[model samples]
Target chain A: MELWYTEKQTEYFGITAKIKETLVAEKTEFQDLAIIDTVEFGRMLVLDGMVMTTVKDEFVYHEMVAHPALYTHPNPKKVLVVGGGDGGVIREIMKHPEVEKAVLVDIDGKVIEYSKKFLPEIACELDNPRVEVIVNDGYMHIHDHKNEYDVIMVDSTEPVGPAVELFTKGFYQGIYDALKDDGIFVAQTDNPWFKADLIRNVNRDVREIFPVVRVYWANIPTYPSGLWTFTIGSKKYDPLAVDESTIPEINTKYYSPRIHKAAFALPKFVEELCK
Target chain B: MELWYTEKQTEYFGITAKIKETLVAEKTEFQDLAIIDTVEFGRMLVLDGMVMTTVKDEFVYHEMVAHPALYTHPNPKKVLVVGGGDGGVIREIMKHPEVEKAVLVDIDGKVIEYSKKFLPEIACELDNPRVEVIVNDGYMHIHDHKNEYDVIMVDSTEPVGPAVELFTKGFYQGIYDALKDDGIFVAQTDNPWFKADLIRNVNRDVREIFPVVRVYWANIPTYPSGLWTFTIGSKKYDPLAVDESTIPEINTKYYSPRIHKAAFALPKFVEELCK
Candidate 1:
């Protein structure tokens, strides 16, 4: 028998991967989580029938989510990540030497548990001394913490179920409140092809709350459209204004000094959507 | 009954689209051709079980192929398109007022016929007075015509069946012989995630024949990985040095003066592949 994993990105379109074996499939407290070994992408983490991360392509998402914000801020010490249970974002956050403490708030602890067992490389940083893993509602966590973090990243799944509130204007307001005076925050907006309105709305909402709001793009094959977008909201610094020559070389697969600015150069339609 | 069309991009992964109806499914003399009306992507042209173009996202691929090389050349008068039977590239080529004539050679006549019937917008320019449509082998056409075109665009499917010869090192040499001394050419190289070797090999092979070779990228959701790459080879002009201010704003959805330069800013891994 052949086992295949399919993500129904939309009603009309989907992507499928051939699975070598199913390691774990269970109903977590928040959503259905699974760890599957695949033929092409190695181990893959699936949440609520959506691909969260895969061993082969996790570097792109992890590097892109953490580095842009960390690099743009002059001195980032306290960082926060919301809804990133797989610990990929946390792994990336540790790459910044200036970071003193990083707090992660994820509603689903099962995701973290399974990731540490299956995706060992991504979850490796979660157990470090400088990291705090909190299993709680990320929405309420942002509501409670005020002016504490220097940088915040929303490494979330699609805006569905528990993540629905994460896409609202109130959430943007909460994230703004949770950051310091010159704080920067980035969120993974959906693809422009099927979720143009979502990207437009997120950009508009983030723009209303932050002085500098920009949308950047990266290609992640396991994602919905493979063209994933990130919306960065900054209080003071501009990402494009950063000097590429000043950036130090780090171990990364996707995000580089050149890509930092190049990612901001959106296609005409995507630029129109952001506007 | 529920119907779905899946393009097995590789042995381990594929993308599936919900089909509204099958407009046409038959074997042309060259290959098996199908025109599928997809619920998500509108009308799609598929040859040899691979997607060539879709009405919804055709502009991204077509615009990226024609505009970059045309704008790089100061005043392109004669342009040649190989294997773009849907006429989408020709339609974009006509947008440049400097172009006096454009010739398109395709091996499969059924693609042109059915695209005219179903994808009328894409096939609109095939009948233009300045355009010549020939149903013949594109490889042989390039071999016969030496130093004839100011710019040549290879608008082809995946390197399979008739397109097999299009990706060879010999074909690059033939394309070099077919272009003027100051000519520029661009071809749709496959994605980096699944076909990195192909991009590397094409870049290496093209660099041997041309003075300057560059690899650029675009987001095309209906394609295999949603990330598509284009390889540009030039004899004299460098695409990177083209003054962005001089490139007039033609009507385009994806390509722009900003994108022309940004597209060449490849990701670190992709840049390494080119090197």
Candidate 2:
């Protein structure tokens, strides 16, 4: 009489949630995808047995993924999101009035299709006039479109299955080539608790390619450790140098003027990992 | 066969970890106590089926609880810890050369005994000459002591079972009465994801008694949510006003000179709750 969904985050650790009903469960070209209604998190999206996003806490991930890069750029007109089939990142990217064009490249169309039906609020801006949705491999897209995007956001899942390539050094090199001269990019680098090595490697890899690299944090409860980290690689601008007073007010629940810089102040242990 | 321990954080959510062995499981006078050796988190102390601390991540929680208050005060010679039976806070407090004496009051003596046996690294300072361990009700201890301590820390578990009174307004008033005129105190205020009301209520209650009150955060993975909060109430000093250059260097893994000020910069949603 009871159904629960659990994501085995590691070999010995996992998180579980009581489910109300399973709306959809299928195998996409890239991975297994499912949409379920849960008691604590509302509608939940799971891919390859990992909780991707929940209605209650998706704002924290989407807002943090988009706002920091968008606000750091002086005039971000073109934005690109890689592997964000849920369209949550695109929705946040489209918030800036200066964004004349926003492109989202996701290999699996089923994730986009199911999200539109189940998570409309997060995928609302995917159909906007200024947005373009492309069903293609994000890795290849970055290689093909060289120096095209002003702000690039990698909204991929953990480094497993199709996402493995997304965490390599070559992918970061491709991201550097995919951005304009003054471009900035950020990638969700997982949590520091269990993924300390992944974050350290990503920080080192990005540091070699970008002049300014910063690691920031946010509290996303549905994630592996709840303390989620993001790595930003910029060509010229330092996210910390941006005068917060000049940043325009945007509708956000988690990201704010004070939080913009605060996020960059990494904890001592986390800062050591960045080194 | 596999053995796992799950802490049901809420009606719909929980976190599970594989257990290599159960070091101790006993029914104390107050609650159920267990020392589980986990595959991922090393030895973990569980009280009433909730994780109290783990060997791997205990540094983050203990450092944040003690360092901020100790460094903020001009010269804290006398300190008091309430309900910290594990003695992790006392270990961190003893690091301060200025502290001449540290008093620990807990409702249960079994926690202190087991911690001394199992989590020796965390409870190492429990037998220090300066630390006086007393198995007594923390609530009554605060009501008895008046203007006796320079810094007081309430290291109780979530406001449940025996700790329910520790979160009430009268307890905050008692803590205010138990501290010197220029004293400062802090308490673990739970997380914001599930316990927003608790954080809001504690902030309001402390604000009523102290001239200055602030909320800070740290990442503690074994707890319900990795994003843990701490509420600090000061009578004559603002924690934010402390000079980082003056807070002498200490041996720590999480708290740093820069992190002292950064932890106070909360996320937008969390700040909104404190308001």
Candidate 3:
């Protein structure tokens, strides 16, 4: 018998991968979560029938989400990652030596717990002393803080269920209040192929609150379209203005000094979606 | 009473789309051909169970394959599209007023005939006076020509049955010999997700023959991984040195002056694949 897992990428389309075995599949408090050891992508994390991360390609998404904004800021001492229960983003954040404190607030503790078990390589850094893991609401944390963090990263799921509130204009305003005057923030804005309006609206809202706003891209094959976009909103620092000499030697499989600038250059259709 | 079309993107992964109707399915002289009208990706052309192009995202592939080479050359008067039977490359190549003539040489006459019937939008320009369509093998065509064309594009399918020679080192050298002293050539190098070694080897082989060789990316969701790359080999012109001012205004839905430069910027991991 063949064991396969399929995600409905759209109402009429799906991507399927042959799996070796199912390690875990359960209904978490907030969403359905599954961890599977697959043949193509290795250990896979799925939430609500959607691919959250895969072991092979997690480095691309994690590094891209952390590095550009982290490097753009003159200093990122205090970092906050909202909804990164998988700990991939936290792992990347801990790599920055200047980051004195890294806080991760996730609504679902099961995501954090299971990731640490199934995806140890990605979740290993969550145990670091420099990192703080909280089982709480990310929006409330942002709303409660004022000028607290140097860089705020939203590593949330698609704008649905608990994550729906995270994409609103009010949440962005809260993020503005949560960051220092020169703070920078970046969020995965989903694929331009399926979520064009999401990216456009987020870019518009972030641009309204931040002095410098840019949209970039990376290729994560397990994502909806393999073309993923990230919108970076900065209070003062511009990601494009990063000094090449200042880019640190981080342990990365994807992100680099040259890639930092290139990520902002979107395809013509994607650039038009920004409008 | 449901119908679905599945393309096995890899040995363990397949992307499936719900078919509203099957436009055409036949065993052609060269390969098995199917034109599917799906609810997700609209009209999709599949050859031997591999997606060649779709009505929805073909622009990304066709535009990326054509514009980068055209913009790099100071003047592209004569262009040769080897194996672009669908005529999408010819359509894009004709957008340049500087291109006096564009020739499309494809071995499969059935592909051209079926494309003209089913993929009218892509095959529309195949009948243009400035365009010449030849039903012949691309490998032999390149071997017969010497120092003739200004630009040559290999818009062939994957390195499989009929197209196996298109990816060989001898074929690349044949392309170098077929071009004028300062001509440019590019071929679709597949995606790095499943074909990392293919991209690395192609870049290495092309670099040995061409003075300037670069690999760039574009996202077409219907493709294997959505992250499709193209390897460009140039004799004298560097795609990076293209002056922004001289880029003529073209009517394009996906290609533009800004994207002409941006497409060359690959993610670090993708860049490493070329090395």
Candidate 4:
């Protein structure tokens, strides 16, 4: 019997990948997740039946979602990462020398545990002293903490299920409340190609609270919409006005100081959202 | 009847798009190309059964390929575009105020004529007096010319078929010879995720001839690999050391002085190629 896996890009298109067997399958309290070894796309990671990351091209999503905000801030001291239970964001954030403390908040604990066990390189820094792993609702955490974090990076799955509320204006305002005046907020918005309306809506929502809001593009191969968008919201500095001279001297697989600034350069349609 | 359109990603994985009917189908001398209204990706341009650009998201590829090199040079007096028959590069190059002359060299004149007739908005600026249209081989043009251009942009098709030579060391050396001492050379390299080997090869080849070589990424939806890379080669100045104060004053859709400097930043995988 062939194991069937469906990849829903949006409502319009879906690719069904037939797998040999379920290498790892679990029904976590939050969602159904699995990591399957396949002939195509190499090793695949799916959460709640939604494709999250694949070994073939996980670098694009992982690097883009983590690097831009981490490298953009002047001095990222205390950082907060919400919904990235996979620990990829934590790995990238740890590359910065100034990041004294990092808090990983996700409603689902199983995702972190599974990722830590399987994807060792991505979750290498999870055991580091600087990290404080918290298994709880990220929304509540944001509301509870005020003016505490220098940077808030949201590495969500998608705008569906438990992650839907993260895209709302209320959650964005809560994020604004959680960050210091000079702090920066970066969230993985959906793909503009498949979800233009969502990208536009999220940009508008983020712009309402933050003085500087910009949408950047990253190409994640495993995603339904190949072209993905990340929206940056900041209170102090523009996302485009980053200092190139002060890049962190760390060995990173992705996320260089040069890329930090380039990531904010929007395409024509994405740039139109700012207008 | 279901009209089947297979977008050949590689020899292995080809995405089959179920279409209703052909909106516009024409066979040029080089390849069979068509513009079809599809159920999933909207109005899609299919060249040799591969999706080149779609109406939903062509800006990512067009803007990224055009903006970085155009904006980086302090003063772009003369610009030469290689293989951009679609006229998208011309549209972006015209945004620079200092660009007194813009030359386009495309082997397929039919592609230029068809794009001008079909996609007028993208090909609108082709008739500008400063824009010189040349129907010849881009490689030959570069080999013959020397120290004439401030910026040389290669917006070729994939590194296969007619474009295979464009990825060679000889071609890059020709581009280097064509550029002025302080001139910049930017070309669309392969996607980092799907075409890592190809990108590395191109990086290696370009680095041999040019003093400075760097690879930058862009999110293009229609391409085979969603994670696209652009390699830049310069003779004198590093792209990262661009002067922000000297940025050109132009109403651009994407490229800015801020982004010009940022495009030089590389991910670890790409930066490894430079070493």
RMSD of each: 1.0, 1.1, 1.2, 4.4
Q: Write the per-residue lDDT of candidate 1 for residues A175-217, one digit (tens) a residue.
A: 9999999999999998999999999999999999999999999
Error of 4 at B114 (Å): 3.6
TM-score of each: 0.99, 0.98, 0.98, 0.79
lDDT of 4: 0.77
In order, the interface RMSDs are 0.9, 1.1, 1.4, 3.3
Best by DockQ: 1
Write model 2 residue lDDT over A94-187, tens digit each, in one string: 8898999999999899999999999999899889999999999999999999999999999998898789999999999999999999999999
DockQ of all candidates, in order? 0.83, 0.77, 0.73, 0.34
The window of 10 residues in a row where model 1 chain B has the poorest summed lDDT is B218-227
By descending DockQ, how would the candidates be arranged?
Answer: 1, 2, 3, 4
Instruction: Give stretches of model 2 more than 4 Å off.
Output: none
B211-243, model 2: which lDDT tens digit per residue?
899999988877776789999999999999998
Q: What digit string (tens of lDDT, one per residue) describes model 1 on residues B1-275?
A: 99999988889999999999999999888899999999999999989888888999999999999999998999899999999999999999999888999999999898899999999999999999999999999999999999999999999889988899999999989999999989889999999988999999999899899999988999898787778999999999999999999988879999999898998888788888999
Ordered from best to worst TM-score, the candidate numbers read 1, 2, 3, 4
RMSD of 4: 4.4
Instruction: State the C-alpha lDDT per candidate.
Output: 0.92, 0.93, 0.90, 0.77
Residue A121 displacement in candidate 3 (angstroms)? 1.0
Which of the two candidates, 3 or 4, achieves a greater DockQ against the reference? 3
